[model samples]
Target chain A: MVADSLVAVTIRSLVLIIVLLTVFAYLMLFERKFLGWFHLRLGPNRTGPWGLAQPIADGVKMIFKEDIIPRDADRFIFKLAPVISLFVAFAAFAVIPVGPPLKIGNWTVPLSIADPNAGVLVLLAFTSLGVYGIALGGWASQSKYSLLGALRSTAQMISYELTMGMSLVGVILLAGSLRLSDIVTAQESLWFIVRQPVGFILFFISVVAEVNRVPFDLPEAETELVAGYHTEYSGMRFAMFAIAEYVNMITVSSLVTLLYLGGWRGPAFLPPVVWFLLKVSFFVFLFIWMRATLPRLRYDRLMAFGWKVMLPVAFLNLVATAAWVAFR
Target chain B: MATRSPEYFTHQGYEVLETLDGDRMILSVGPHHPSTHGVLRLILELEGETVVRCTPEIGFLHTGIEKTAENLTWQQAITVIDRMDYLSPLSNNLGYVLAVEKLLGLEVPPRAVTVRLLLAELMRIASHLVWLGTTGLDLGVQSMIMYAFDLREGILDMFEEVSGARMNPSYFRVGGLAADLTPEFERMLRDWLQRFPKRYEELRALMEENPIFLDRVRGVGAISQEDAIAWGLTGPNLRATGVSYDVRKAFPYMGYETYDFEVPVGTAGDTYDRYMVRVLEMWESYKLVQQALERLPDGPWQTDDRKIVRPPKHEVRESMEQLIHHFKIVSYGFDVPAGEVYVPIESPRGEFGVYLVSNGTNKPWRVRVRPPSFYNVMAIPKMLEGNLIADLVSVVATVDPVFGEVDR
Candidate 1:
C-alpha cells in the first residue's frame, strides 16, 4: 500500500527521471570513450579530466545553441516530435524494476516509479509508441532525407517489434506472470538465458533494431541519409532526440537484465543495485561493440532478414516455450 | 507554384519533382553532403528508395587549374598540377613533369627515375588507403577510417621529409626531383614498410570477414566489363570488372616495366570487387616500393644541362655564367621548343595524362590534364542503375572520385 501512495510515486518518478537523464548523459561519454579505445584513439579528453565533464559541457552547449524550425516545416509537429520521443523513452522506465523494493524502518519504497501487473506489456507499448515520434518528426521536417529515414524507421521498427514481443513470450510463459519483478524472481534459481537462449538472442537483435542502433541504424545513417530523421533539427530540439536515443538504450539494457539476466541477483558481497548496474552495463558495452564492428544492413536485406528469418524463429521459440510450460 | 500544369513540370525538367503526378522523390545528394567526397552533387530521382535517374552535377570545386597552369612557367606549373588529384599529388607531379621533360628533350638521371618510381608506388598505396577508409565509412564501419588514416600518416611523414610538405608536395621537377631523398625519408619508409602489411591485413580482415559488410557490398552497384570500358572507367574501377588494362603495364613510365609486381583484377564489377581490387593494388604497390628501394642507385638526381636544371646555389654565387643561367631560370624560366607533347603515366587513380603545348616562350601555350577521376565519375549513373540510395554511397566511395580532379 505504501508503494502505491501518490506522494511515493511522485517522489520516485522525480528521482528516477533525474537519475535516468544523468545516466543517459554519462552513458554517451562512456560510449565515446569506449568506442575511441576500440578505434585506437583518445576520445573526448579535452573537456574535463579524462572528459568526465564532457556530457555537462555538451548539455550547456546544446541549451545555448539556436533552435531553428525550417520555414517550410510543419511548425507545431516539428516542435512537438522530440518531446514525444523524450517522453516515451522516459515513460518506459516506470514499470522496469531496477532492484527489489527498499525497506526503511516500517516504510517500504518501490524502486520503480510504477508497479503494474502487466509491466512488460506496458514497457512494450511505450517502446512501440516511440515510432510515432520518429515517423512524425521526419514527415514534419519537410526534407526528403528525413522523410526517407522516417519511412525506413517506420518499416524497420514495426517489423522488429513483433519479433521482440514474441521473444519475450518465452520469458513470460516461463515466469507465468507479466510483472517484470516476477520475471526476475522466477530467475532466482536459473537465469532465463540458459533456458531461453534462442529467445535471448532474438530479443537482443530485435532490441538493437528497435532502438535503431548500428547495423540497424538506417534511420540516422549519416553517410547515406545525411543525418536522417533529425536532418533539419538543431540545438536543444536535436539534443532531445539524441537524449531520447541514449535513454532508450539504457531502458532496453535494463529490460534485458530484468528478463534474461538474473536482474539484481548476484553474489551476497555486493548490493542488489550494483549487480543490476553491472548487468545493464554489460549489455550497453555489447551494443557499443556491435556499433564499432558491424556495417549497416541494406534496407531491403534488413526487411527480408526480419520477415524470413527473425520472425519465423521467434514464433517457433514462443510456441515451443508454451508447449514446454504446458507439459511441465 | 502549386498551380503549375503537368506540361510545365515536364517542360522544366521538373517531371520527377511533380508531387501531384506520382510518388517520385528528388534528393539533391551533395555539394554539401558528408559522403560526396567533396563538392560533387548527384541529382537523384527516387521512386521509393531506388534511384530512377541520377544526374551528376560537377564543377563546384573548379579552380581553373588548367588555365592557371597556362600562366605559370612550364616547371612552375607543377604546383597547380599537384592540386588536381589532391589525394595523389606526387602522381600529378610525375605526369606534368614527364610531359614537360618530353617537350624539352631532356633526360633525367637514373637515380631520379628510381626515386620517382618509389614515390609513385608509395603514393598509390596512400591513395588506395583513403579509398578503402572512406568506403568503409560510407558502408557504416566507422572505425575503418581511423585505422586507415593512422597507417597513411606514416607515408605522409615520409613525404614531408622528402619535400618539406605532406599532401601536395610538388616534389617533382621538369628535369628531375626538387631535391634528393633525405636519409630520414628512407628510414621512415623502411619503418612504414615494416608496419604496413600487418595493419593492411587487419583492415582487409575487418572488411572481408564480416558477413554484414559482404551483404552490403556484394552484387550492389555492379557494372559490366563492357559498360566499364564504354564509360571510360580505369584504375580499380575498371580492374574490378575483370579488365587488365593498367597503364603501368601497357605503357611503362618511370621504368614501371622493371618493377616485379602483379596487377590485381576482379571478376565481378560490384562494390566488393572494386574494394578487393584496390586492396590488392595496395599490396602490389608495397612490393613495387620494396623493389625500387633495393635497386635505388647513387648518382645525380637532375640533368647536367644548366639550360634546363637550375644551377647549384654555390655555383650561381661564384660563376658569372652559372649566375645568368640560374637567374634566367628563376626569373623568366627556360623556354621550351615550339612543339607539343602528351605523356601519360599510371597514377593511382588511373592513367593520369598531361598534354603540354610549348610556344618557344617562357610560359606554356597550353597545359591540359587528363584527370582519371573525371572518367571514373562519368560511370556513376551507369553503376547506380536500379540500385538503392545506400548503394549510391558505396558506389561513389568505391569509385573514389576526387572532385578536385573531376572539376579541375
Candidate 2:
C-alpha cells in the first residue's frame, strides 16, 4: 500500500515537471510567433516543421554556449542565484492542480504534487522568494547596470506584492478558504471574475508587474540596464533565469485560472485538463499581446501607481467583498 | 561647495563617520548603452532610482572628420560629411554643398534644387521613422522597433535606387546632385507617398494616446523655453519648447519660403511634446515632398557653368577646353576662390551648418560643422536632473542626439 502511494506520487511529480518545462519552451515559441504577427514580420520557422523544434534547438544552443562569469563577480552567490530562481519557480507549481482528482478503484488521489491546506500562502511565499534570486544575481554581478536592475526589481516586487496580496484577500474573503482547490471549488456556480471584476483587474495588473513583464518591466528595462539583473549571467545560467520567468508566467496564469476563470471547469464533452489549458493559454496570450503593445512604466510612476492607485482600490475591494459575503 | 549631504557625520572633515541622510551612489550609464544612440557615457549621481545629477560624457565616437575635410577636395568632402549625421546624409550634403555654392557664387538649376528638396524631405521622414521606432523600443514597446524598421526600409529603397547606397547616398554634389532621378525613383516615391499615410496613422495609433505610453513620456523630460534657447536646442527639439525656431523659417533654403507647410510647434517642452512635434513635422514633410514631386521643374539638372559644374559628355569628346575642364575637375577638382561662408540649413534634427574657408585651392582650408545634435545632447543633464534613472532613457530618446553628429 505504501509502495503504491509512493509510486503514484513519484510518477505524478515527474509528469508535472516534464509537462511544465515543455510548456515553458512552447510558450516562448508562441510569444515569438505572436509578437512577429503583431510587428507584421515572419517569426522563426527555420528550425523544424513550422518551427516546432525551435525550442529544442534553442535549448541545445544554450547548453553548448560557454558559461561566463565576470572576473570580479561573487562566485558563490552568482552560481546560486539562477538555481534559486529556477527552484522557486518550479516549486510554486507543486500545489497547482491541472485537473480534478482522479479515482483508480479503491485508491483516490488529487492531480497535484501536494494539495496543501495553505496553498495560497505557499504560492505567495514561493513567488515572492523568486525575487531574491534576481536581487542576489544583481548584487553578485559586481556591475552598476545589474545593481540598478536588481534595485528596481526589488522595489517593484515589494510594491506590487502589497497590491497582489490585498487583491487576493477579496477572493479569500468570498471563497472563505486559503486552499487554491477550495477557491476553484467555491467557483462551481460562477467564476470569481464575475463577482470581482475590480479584484480581477487589480490581480492582473499587479501580477503583470510581479512577473516582470512589459509596461511593468522596469527591473530589466533593456534600454536602461542592458539586461538588468541577468546582465552578467551567460549560457545556461542565463537560460535558467529565462526558464524561471516562463515558469512563473505559467504558474501565475494557472493561479488566475483557478481563482478567477473556473479552472478545469467547462461544459460537458471537453475534458477538465483541456478546459484548464485553454483558459491558461488565453491568459498567456494576453500577456504576450500586452508585451507587443504597451510601453514600460517609468520606475517612480510604477511605484506611485502601485501604492496610490492599486493598493487603495484593493483595500476598498476587500471591504466591499467582506460586507457582501457577511450579508450572504 | 560640498556635494554630499550636510546631515552626514564626518570625521576630520574628510571621512564620513555616520550618515543622517540616505547614501548617494554614482552610476555610469554607458559608452555602450542600448539607448544612448551611440557611444555616449553618462555619470549619474543617484539617490536610489532618482537621479540627482546627470553628466553626459562624449567624444568616444570622435573621428576627426573636420580635420580630414581640409585634405579632401571640395567634391570629395561631401562624401566624408555624409557620415556626420549619417541617418540624414542628404541634409549634411545639402548644408556642405550650399556652403560651397555660396563661396563659388554658383546658381543651382531649378530642377536640381527641387529634387534636392524632395529627397531632403524624404530623408527627414526616414530619420523620424527611425527615431519613432527606437524611442518606442527604449520605452519597452517591443514590437515597435521592427515596425519602424519596416517602414524606414521602404524609404531606404528609394534612396538606393537613386544613389546605389541606402544610408550614405552622398547623392548631392558641390554644385548640384550627383545623379539625375531615374524613372524608377518616381514610381518608388509615388508608392511610398501612397502607402505611408496609412502607416503614419498606424504608427500614431500605436502609442500617441496610449495611457501607459503617455504616462511614460508626457510631462517627463521637460525643458523651459529660456533654458532651451540658452542651450541652443534646434529643430523639433527647439520647436517642442515653444520657441518656434525653425531654420527653414528663419533662414530659407532650397526655395523653402515658397513651400506651403506649417512648422509644427509644441507648448510644453516634454518628451511627449517632442514626440508629437516630430510626428507633425513628418506630416509637414510629407506634404512638402508631395508638392515638390508634382511641381518638379524640367530643365538643366546642374548649373550651366563650366567652372563648377562638370562639362557635358559630348562636349568633353569634341572640345579640348571641355576635355581639359572635365580632367581638371576629375583630378585636381574645381577651386573655390578664397572666401569664408557659413550656411545654416534645416536638417531633420535641427540647424545643420557648414562653415567653410577657401584658400583659392581645390581643397578647403577649413571645414567645420555646426551639428544640432551636439547642442541638443548638452541639454540632457538639465532634463535628467530629479528624474528617475528609467526616465533617462526617454529623456535621451527625446533629445534624439545621434552620437555620429554629436562627437563629429
Candidate 3:
C-alpha cells in the first residue's frame, strides 16, 4: 500500500511539473500581449491567430539557435549552471498547493507534490540554490560584465533574502504553520493582506528584488552590465535562464496569493483551483504592471534599502504579527 | 645606505604609501547601448567602476548634412535641419529658416511668427517627452519610455497634419512656413494641452517620489555650477546647475521676450535635477504654445518678398514676371551678399547656431553649425569621473545628446 502511494505521489508530482511549465510558457505570452496593449501596439500576433503559438515558436527558435561557449569559459561549470538554475526554479513549485484535496475512487490527491512539514523552509532553500546558477554562470564566463553582474546578484540576493525571509515570518506566525496548504487554509477567515499590510508590502518589494525585476535589476542592467550574468550565455542555455525567471515570477506570485490574498477562498461560483489561479494571475499582472511602470533601483541604494529599510520593517512586522496572534 | 635614505625622507616629511600603476582598462560603452538615446560611443578608461577618463567617438550617423544643405537652396536647408535632432525637427526647421530670413532681410508676417512659436514649443515638449522616456528606460523605469512615446505620438500627429511628415518636417522656409497650420492641428493641440497635465501628474506619481529612483539619481553625477559653465554645457544640462542662463531669456531671439515662461533651475546639478528641469520645461513649453495660439494674428503666412518666396501657383500661370521669378528661384536659387552671419537659436538641446559664409553665390562658401549635442557629449568624461559604472546610464541620459547632431 505504501509503495502504491509513493508511485501515485511521483506521478502527481510529474503532472504538476508539466502543468506549471506550460503555465510558465503561457505567462510570457500573456506579458507580451498585456504590454503590447499598454503600448498601443500589437505584440507577437504573426505566430498564430492572436499569437497562440508564439510561445511554441519562441521555444523552437531557442532550441535551434547555436549554443555558444566563450573561449576562456569554464565549460563544465557553464553547462551545469543553467541546469542548476532551472532545477531549483522547477523544484520550488513542488511545495506550492494549487488547490484543495481531490478524491477519485479509493485514492486521495493532496493537490500538491509534497506536503512536507517544513514546506516554507524548502521553498526558501530552493530559491537560495537558484542564485548559485547565476553566480556560477557569471564566474564561469570569465568576463568583466558577467563578473560584475554576478557580484551584484550575489550581494542583492543575500541582502534582500534576509528581508524576504523575515517578511514571510509574519505570514508563518499568523498562519501558525510552515506548510503552504496550512497557510492557504489560514486565509479562509480573512486575507492576511488586510491584517498584516506592512508584511505584504515588505514581502512584495523584497520578492521584486529577489526576482531581479526592474528597479531591482541592477545585476542585469543592460545599459551598464550588458546582459549581466547571461552576457556570455546563448541558445538553449540562455532560454533555460529566461524560463527560470518567469517560473520564479510564477512561484512568488503564487506564494503571495496564498499568504496574503486569501488563496482559493473567493466567491463560491469558482472552484478552489480557479480561485487560486485568479488570485495568482492578479499578482502576476501587478508584477508586469510594475515592470512596465517603474524604473530600476541603483546598486548602493538597493543594498541600503534592503538592509536598512526593508529588513527592519520586515522584522517589526514579524514581531507585531506574533504579538497580535498570541493576544487575539 | 638604506638607513641614511630613510632618515633624509623622514626629515623632508614626504611619505609615499603606494604608487598607483596599472594599464587603465579601456571600455567601449555604446553604439547600441540603452542609455545612448541613439547610436553614440563613449570610450572609457576605468580604474575599477570609477571612470578615469572618457572620450566620445562620434560619426556613427553622419549623413553629410552640411554638404547636402549646400546643394539644396536656402529654402530647402530647413529639411536638412529637420534630421539634425529628429525629435524636435520643427525647432531645427525654425532655426534654419530664421537664419536664412535674417540673411535675406525678409520680414515674416506676425501670423507666421506666432505659428512658428507654437510649433517650436510643441517640438520642445515632444523632444522632452523622448528624453524623459528614454532616460527612464535607461534608469530601469521601463514604463516611462512607453508613456513618453505615447505622449510624443500625439505631438507627431500634429506635425504630420502641418508638415506631412512625422519626423523630417522641412515645413519652415526662408520667407515663412511651408504650409499654414490645419484647423485640426490647433484642435488637437488644444485637446492635448487640456489632458496632458493630468498624465504628467500620473508620471510623477509613478517615479518622482519613489525612494528607489530618488536614491539612484539624487546626488549621482553631480556637477557644480562653475564646472558646468567651464565644460560649456547648455540647455537643461546647464540649467540643472542652478544657472538661469537661457538663450531665449538672455539674447531674446525669435520674439521670445514677449512669451511668458519661466526657466526652471535645479540647485543640485545631478541626473535627477536635470530630469526634473526637463519635466518642468515641458509644462512651460505647453504654456507658451497655448499663449501663441491665443495671440495668433490674422495676416499673410509668408513674407511678401518676391525674390525670396516663390510666386503663387495661380500667379505663375497668369503672369510672365511671376513665372520668371519662380523659375529663377527653383532652378538656380537666390544669392546672398558676400558676407557672413552667425545666428544662434535656443534649441531644445542647447544653443544651436548656424554660421553661413556667403561668397556672392547661391551656394554658401562655408556652412558650420555649432551643434549642442557635440558639446554636451564632450562633458561626459568630466561628469563620469569618480562615479560608479551603474551611474553612467543616468549621467549619459541626463546629457541627452542626439547622435545626428553630435556626429554632424
Q: Report the number of the highest-TM-score candidate.
A: 1
The true-versus-predicted C-alpha distance at residue B79 of model 2, in Å, is: 0.9
Per-residue C-alpha lDDT of model 1 across residues A1-328, encoded as one tens digit per residue? 4757777788889999999989988999999999999888998999989999999999999999998988889999999999999999999989988899999897888889877999999999999999999999999999888998999999999999999999999999999999999999999999999999999999999999999999899999999999999999999999999999999999999999999998999999999999999999999999999888889999999999999999999999999999999998
Query: What is the lDDT for B281 in model 1?
Result: 94
**Candidate 1: DockQ?**
0.67
True contacts kept of 3: 0.67
Q: What 10-residue stretch in candidate 3 chain A is worst by lDDT?
A: A1-10
Per-residue alpha-carbon lDDT of candidate 3 for residues B1-408, written as tens digits (9 for 90 to 100): 011233343344434212324544556677876677788887665676677766676789999888888777666676786788877777777777777777767789998988888888888999998888888778777767888888888988988989889988887888888878888988898898888999888877777878867877888898889988998888999999999889889988769999899999999999989989998999999889889989999888988787877888999999999999999999888887777888888889988888887787887767788888888888887888888888889899889998888876
Q: Per-residue lDDT tens digits of candidate 2, residues B74-172?
A: 999988899999789999999999999999988899999999999999999999988999899998887888888888899999999999999999999
Clash counts for all predictions: 0, 0, 6
Model 1 CAPRI quality: medium
- Rank candidates, lDDT, best first: 1, 2, 3
User: Clashes in model 3: which pairs?
Assistant: A215-A296, A215-A297, A292-B143, A295-B140, A295-B141, A296-B140
- Consecutive 10-residue window with the lowest summed lDDT within model 1 chain A: A1-10
For candidate 1, what is the TM-score? 0.98
Clashing pairs in 2: none
Instruction: Note the DockQ of each predicted structure.
Output: 0.67, 0.60, 0.43
Name the runs in model 3 displaced over 4 angstroms: A1-6, A170-177, A184-197, A260-269, A317-328, B1-26, B45-49
Against the true structure, whose DockQ is highest? Answer: 1
